[model samples]
Target chain A: MTAWQTKLTETFGDACKFETFRDNIRCDVRTERFLEVMKNLRAQGFDLLLDVTGIDYLHYPKAADRYGVVYSLVNTESGERAYIKVRLNDPDPAVPSVYSIWKGCDWMERETYDMFGIVFEGHPDLRRILMPEEFTSFPLRKDYPLRGRGERHNFPTVLRSDG
Target chain B: MPLAPAAQYPIDADETPDHEYLYTLNFGPQHPATHTTLRLILTLDGETIVKAVPDIGYLHSGFEKLGEDLDYNQYVTIVDRMNYISPICNEIAWHHSVEKLMGLELTPRCKYIRTIIAELARISDHLLCVGAAALDLGGITAFLYAFNMREKIYNIFERMAGQRFHPSYTRVGGLMFDVDDGWVSLIRTFIKDEFPKAHTDVARLLNRNKIFIDRTKGVGVLTKEEAINRSASGPVARASGVVRDVRKEEPYLAYKDLDFQVICGTGGDCASRYLVRMGEMNESAKIISQAVENIPSGPINIDVEDKLTVPDKSSTYRSIEGLIQHFELFMWNRRWKPPVNECYGATEAPNGELGFYLVSDGDGKAYRAKTRPPSFIHFSLFPHLIEGHAIGDVPAVLGSLNIIAAELDR
Candidate 1:
């Protein structure tokens, strides 16, 4: 294990599971314990949260995890990055929001929720961001049809009175 | 958090508050200064903005969803629309991520060529940002001066990639073609002769102008702490004195070898952001000149044996082997399949940190392709920065950030 991975594992104990890939460190944490780990990571100078995105593993037949939320964080001083990921099963894919830890994750969590239908428990404005508020479906899921479910045609046309 | 009148905030409730009411103002989904369809719902106490809430998603196109459907090679066309101002930067960034996923190292010549093109794209993107920002602040002369130079860069793009706007010129392993001698000379001329003169003209028109300075200075200040907290990047963060340039820190492509400076600003105002971008343009021109002079001569693409790169036209037309290689590359089933693990590859896009997070399920198509667009993060900082400022300063702030709507929505 690299020094950072060792530090993370030492800090978080069994909750931190490190996966190193191509000079990048990806630390997968237990869903319930991720918020605690994230707070500590924030205190440890992992200042900037780069992105928050969700991945559905329905198409990956061999994979055990059904849904995953990936948080890419960066140490602004060193430019070193790490990914904190949490896996969830079917029915309820929920994770604690990291908005309080890194304020940047507010919209990112909203975007993740908008696209993946992932319930962020403590997010202040937990609503659809990129998609319309009325839009029901999460278009980013692997099971979602590429051409869409004809939602574009469902809206009623509002023509101008003189037109 | 219910919408209320101004009287609620006053403790005494008798400080002449009954006559004053907070009214709502919508800046866009159609405002001219907002270069794209971005809606900002501002709670205004007369002219000064009390609070601001950005209502995005007006331009969401589901590009990430589209990326999952398209193959690694086929998705370059879709990525081009993310930042329309610097389409080649998007191409290079996408391909850079794709190549990282595939674990391919492009040739030395390919690196130099990409560095030159990417820097050109940066200059052009900054040119548009500076032009539009100045134009928004009623400086039409500077806008024309900047764009006149931008047209020459577009001409170079047209010559090199065959498209001025959405040049999907970058492939997974390398570029679509090599830069010819004439194209190189054109780029050299653009860097050496044209850019400095136009840059000076624009700078002279806006930099020290009293009206420009009065409107920009000490307005929409995003402090260094706030800049970091909001995860703002590129000139927005740099203007606030955040030393985070991906080209300087990460050094992808030929940037490590090339000589350039990551221009930063301490003022953190609209004027500072404008100055940072202007400084970056000069630095980009410097990098372009250095790269053009020292670009190594080698195969532009990875070797044909890799099967990830398209064969040259001469080879494809003259030899059956080259034809088969070309067919195999683009064929649906025969396209390259990467490992199942995921990797997040980022490039220092003109705006900021543009990253591509790709998850491959051991298939030709990516399982999940998430783009960390700089505009999205930068736009998130809008509400915080624009608060307590005059409504008219909205354009100045937004223009400085240079948020492309497509990128924000994507």
Candidate 2:
């Protein structure tokens, strides 16, 4: 973790805010500089894009940002991992897609978009993944009710006679 | 590794095929070779798969939404259903994330027990995959031999956790129940006798079988670069010569003490995937045997002063303080005072890296609980792997990928 932190501090000093949590490096990158920083990090040897998850901090006590898109990257060589977090304002939060860096993030980005309604700008195939194609609600959002809003009830029942 | 079987099985030159019209085929959604519910919308040129669009989400059960409502301990039930093949792995992964978030250190005994069970889960998961692959490729004998061994593992689980399939067996700081010597003996018996005999049986059955080799050898070849680019892990990536295993790379539980080689395959084909899983099952058995033999004697959970795990049954029944603690734990809840922070904890599950990214707001339940299921990422690799293969080769490739449908759509 220290190995990457020093290089990160030297390269993107003030641009990327660095912090440590539970033996891994976490950097807060601004939304505009997200793509550039990621491309640079890819060059820095974080080859594997482990995960892309979205967080809706609607009523969170700590975070000031409304939505958060977390990109977990790993350097398979040194076994080093770091998280690149880009915070965005609500009402159509968008972050540049890392699909250009790692083609594997395609489904992850789509899933994030499907859940948090956080659009991944420049994603190749951005669509709902875990939810139905016609689903209108972002189910994972804090505002979305747990039991659902009669979405399941509205589904056309296919009875035995109808079949 | 051989490329697609276009040379082996070509479009018949006898028929005058229309160039403009391509046959649209629905491979699955409900098919035996799919082994689960997932639809691959394939654009075909004769018998070859031109392109595949996997239509998933048939098993979306609002799992993440339910995570928001349930507390940390109660959410284990939902996690079990994520990768339902080896349900204990899901439980371990969920608790691993929660424990990391809450900064809890498990006891030595607990760590050893978890390591054994985790390896058991890995073995069980691989058996089902390998057995199903054999079954899909028309080798029922291997499948039967594999399931017989898997049933023994289930017996161990039933003895230890009281459930066979969906074992909600892990808690935040510890396990559901501590194992007795009888359970340890059962695990030892499986590891020593049942595992080796079954492994040998399946190896003998499929390793040299001409049909199995011909069907899987060159089918669905994935290069090391493509595997890395697609974020493939576990046996899938290892079979492609990507020497990355979360257990060896990031030592957790009792893995650091256990000695086992991270298996790698040179072929990067369906056959290599099968071989990698076969080699890994042996490694998992070795790990279990070592851990079971060197079992530690101590308490299973963290210190009671931490107030994380449930009190022992004896204390709960006998003592007044224990009853109140139980009452506070379930009824009042909201006892957690963890730091308002977030962490991503990953485990090298049987499939791949099963991780949980938890955001704690100093509350009982997670502010955000995002699961990083391996199958979801692996499913995306389908289009690339099955691009040029024949329709008949779909089962061989799919079985190698071992896409647990629920995990992919969860």
| Residue B104 lDDT in candidate 1 | 94
Candidate 2 CAPRI-style tier: high
Tens-place lDDT digits, model 1, residues A55-103:
9988785889989999998899877888999999878889998888889
| The TM-score obtained by chain A of candidate 2 when compared with the true chain A | 0.92
- The two-chain DockQ for each candidate, comma-separated, is 0.74, 0.80
Question: Candidate 1, which segments miss by more than 4 Å at Cα?
Answer: A155-162, B1-20
Model 2 chain A: ten consecutive residues of lowest lDDT? A1-10
RMSD of each: 3.6, 5.0
